[model samples]
Target: MVSVYKKILFASICIFALSCKSKKEEATKQNTTQQATLVDVIIAGTQQLSNTIEANGNVVANESLEIHPEVSGRLTYLNVPDGASVSAGTILAKINDADLQAQLSKSKSQLSLAEKTEERLRKLLAVNGINQADYDAALNSVNNIKADIQLLKAQIDKTVVKAPFAGVLGLRMVSPGAYITPQTILATLQETNKVKIDFTVPAIYADLIKRGATVSIINNNEPKRTAVIVATETEINTTTRNLKVRALLGGVPINPGAFVKVLIDAGKQINSIVIPTNAIIPDATSKKLIVVKNGKGTFVNVETGLRTSSGVEITKGIAVGDSVVVTGVLFVKPNAPVKIKSVKNLTELTKEQ
Candidate 1:
């Protein structure tokens, strides 16, 4: 009975040891499989961001107008030189002036007959063969006919349409023999050679926007072009709190209505740390960034400054030489170990695309 009891106790101890060892091995494997999350990062450094204020802008033709007739009539002759240059005072179109011309002719014949009758009445009055009232009526008829002729001439002039200024014509909207009214648009004219940059800036910069002050223009990430401040709206917008500004472009003409960026020199360049805009982690209370420190991702709060087409300025929280996680921001957890796949510079991290 003692020998049987010893064997049973030994088997029970062996089973218990095996069970404990298996659990330990399983836990060890789980820990090893739970590796660090891989991510790409950018090294923060002081960058020379343009010490300028940036704003959205559009290319505007210096002079633009819709071609409309002063008088309404059937267009007997239409000469819309589409996409062609025209000089001031050039006749663009003509209305049917035949009726006005015929009226003018009839008035001239009536004036001639009235003048003859007035002369005969004057002669008769000289001899006391007619009353003074009769001579006066004859004289009044001649004056009335002359005035009618003058009125007809003025109406004929209104039937013609002329270019107001030298400009390039746009597509024609009306065809010949079309009975047009004052509201009808014949075409559009624009001075394409001269273009102005139209942009709005914050009202706080109102005092800085002066007439004839030079500013910079950038398009498609190309080199900067210079433009001079030409004019500004008198009052600040009540709704937007922005001041409308127009600058004259001095270089090659940009297509009207094309989007461009305006850069105004705001005193000096800002040499501060900047990071990719995507790397920012927006929080409810403050902005944050995933920073890699000692092989771990730590969320750090940061204050931002002037933002440009390239990157955002980091005014506070992030330091120079810090590793800021650019990619895999959502997958990273606070105080969790992360794998650094590669480090990039400010330019390589983000582009204006």
Candidate 2:
């Protein structure tokens, strides 16, 4: 009878212990259910956003040429020094033309003699002392001699090289009295008052690019520069399937053949709803944002536009003045109770970071 009474006491102690554990678990679950998620929210507003396309490009001079002589002769005179700025029609160099000069002088003498003979024949023909055919022969001789003089003059002009346009000359390759040929390179000349930024884009963007469209450029370690789209290739490249484009840069100095980053403005400025980039949660087909409304978390679907450095442009879904949850997004679900910890602007949030 004493052993039965001890067994009953042990069972009662076990049941009491299980009841206390169950009560503790029920209290813990109730506490968790009553807790509200804390999130940082931001007010969406309209801002001006530039729509641009980023590309790689190279800089080039507005005009460039590898200057060379048109004829073969010894360089007698190099009037312009190396690396000198010259205007159009400025004498650059002269080739030896002593033989051609001698020929020119002889032709002038012959022309002068033919003129005198023609004058005498005209007077004689008036008196009927010479036939019409004889006078015509004298006149033809005068014209032929004059043509010879003009030919010699053209050959002499070819020996004197002049600058084709206003530009800065590059290094000099030939010296005075150096025998050079038409194939010999004298130097390079480039007009760099402005520059051309050449770049390429995929054929898909062909319709978006047009003449007079503006673009931004940044060279190595240089500030951003603006350029205007001057021209584009009509045909697309088959190998790369890209369209070649050229833009003119003014006010900013750039070297020829310099590698640069190009940003073409594809759209004009317009008011767009922007929000913090962290607030967006991208899914496979769409993006989601946690919007705080009436102290609750609301999931919203949004269509995105231009993406900026600090924020992203929202074209659809959330409207202006809507509070978007930026913090504690991972811990919250739709329609869950939420407490706003702080409301900050997108730019302010960017600055704080």
Candidate 3:
């Protein structure tokens, strides 16, 4: 009887311990179900997306010309200083004009005498004091003198060099007292108020590049300015398979021959859903986006369009107003319970960064 009671009491203690362990296990499971993984999410929305083509480009002055004399003579007077700003028609240099000046003075004197003779002949002819033939000859002499004076003045004007347009001058290549010819370069002038940017893109974009399209310029990875498309080559370059394009950079001063990067918008604006670039999980086969639905993380295969600094455009598999797990994307798995700690738009997140 003592052995049976001992055995029964031991069995009852074992049963009691088992029941307590079972309750503890159930409570632990409940706690885990309530505690969800915290994550930062953002509601996807439609954004205007533009397709852009990037290419290397160079800067050129809007109007660049080498200053040269129209007529050859000794550079007698040079008032143009190196790198000086000159207005349109500003005299930059002067050639020898002493001979031309002398001829002009002599012609003026002869013209004055011929005019007096013609006036006297006209008065006499009116009163029939001289014949018509003689008066005609006197009038012809006055006209001939006037023509000679005009020719001398023209020759004198050729002895000077003037700025063609308002611009900044480059280094003077010639000095006063140097004999310069029509081919001799005196200096260079550049209109820097606006600049031209020449770039080429693959011929596939020829149809997209049109007049008045806007492009962005970058210098050494920094944004420099914006330019507008002025023109494009009609025929594609056979060797390069590229289309030459020109744009004007207004309100931004860039020197000619500067190398820059050009970004051309090749597509029209389209409303599309976009998400943060970080939100994408690129896989070998397809790209995936972590979308939170019904409090669980779901991986959805997505097709992407244009990728920009702002965000990545979602072409398919995601809609506007869907919440995407931007933060903690790599850590989360499919169907895992998630609790959104905070929500933000992609634009807002970029601003904070």
Candidate 4:
């Protein structure tokens, strides 16, 4: 009976030891869970965004060219009524074609003589008084002389420069007596009644704008004027990544080549997740941010777009409902328990200094 009692006493001591050890382990786990890092987080969300981009533009004329002489000669007549409008085919300048006119007159006289000689040869051939070869030679000479006369007349016509279209003329660089060449810029002629605005918009906005769309023109803070898009370049500029666009403003009295500003509105982006720039941690290959899930920090790689005054756009990785740890990015440990002090809206977090 004494041996049985000793066996029961040993069993009770073993059970007591096991219970104490289990309780110590549970207490250690509770202490670890309570010692969580405190952090503030913002719920990731999206907002409606409308983007406006500025463009530098210049006023252009519907038709513009430098009045250049087709041939080199002394100007015998120049009709650049400085800043005056002229109709198409109006004679703007006249080169001294007196020599050409004299040569044409002489050619006409030779033609008359050749024709008379051909007629005489024809009559002789009709009477069988001359060989066929002789009449043929005289007829060939008359035709050659007529061709020479026409050539001289054409040369004389080229000495006069006529306005190609109805346009306002610039100041004359040469006088009536000034000798000019084909390289000389006599004056500038531009049709400014229908002015065009040539500008460049960012290539990202290319899809938002097309031919027949309208752009706003601001000339030195003047009232905004509307210009209808007339043309666009086939491809974007490789260096600047801008698309060249041309817009027309009819009946607007803006001088050609004047500097102007343009505004392009690329419509809204709805429900775009944006985050503070500081929350992003630069990785070697990708950008990353911290997201809180189940009271633990999780690192996520994100794609970005369209950074503006507000914040950077989060294109991928983080969802709309995820809580992003913005305030303690440097202190937050990945996959570690974090005590979220409070959940704030994105706007409230962004407004923090």
Best by lDDT: 1
Candidate 2 local lDDT, 320-346, one digit each (tens): 889899889999988988889888877
| Better lDDT candidate (3, 4) | 3
Q: Rank the candidate models, highest TM-score first.
A: 1, 2, 4, 3
Q: Point out the higher-scoring one by TM-score: 2 or 4.
A: 2
Cα-based TM-score, every candidate: 0.79, 0.64, 0.62, 0.63
What's model 2's overall lDDT?
A: 0.88
- The stretch of ten residues in a row with the least summed lDDT in candidate 3 is 28-37
lDDT of 1 by residue, 134-246 (tens): 99999999999998988888889888988888888999999999999989999998877778999999998888899989988988867999999999999999999999999
**Clashes per prediction?**
0, 0, 0, 0
Q: Tens-digit lDDT track for model 3 on 1-353?
A: 99999999999999999999999999987886775678899988888777776788998999999988889888889977888899999998899988889888988899899999999999999999999999999999999988998888888888877888899999988777898899999989999989999999888778778899888899775665788999988789999999999999877577788899888777677888888888889999999998899999999999987767788888998888888998888778789888898998777878765
Model 3: pairs clashing at backbone N, Cα or C within 3 Å: none
Q: What lDDT score belongs to each candidate, Candidate 1 first?
A: 0.89, 0.88, 0.87, 0.86
Measured on C-alpha atoms, candidate 1 has an lDDT of 0.89
lDDT tens readout by residue for model 4, 227-307: 999999999999999999999988657988799988777666556888878889999999999998887889999998766
Per-residue lDDT value at 145 in model 1: 91
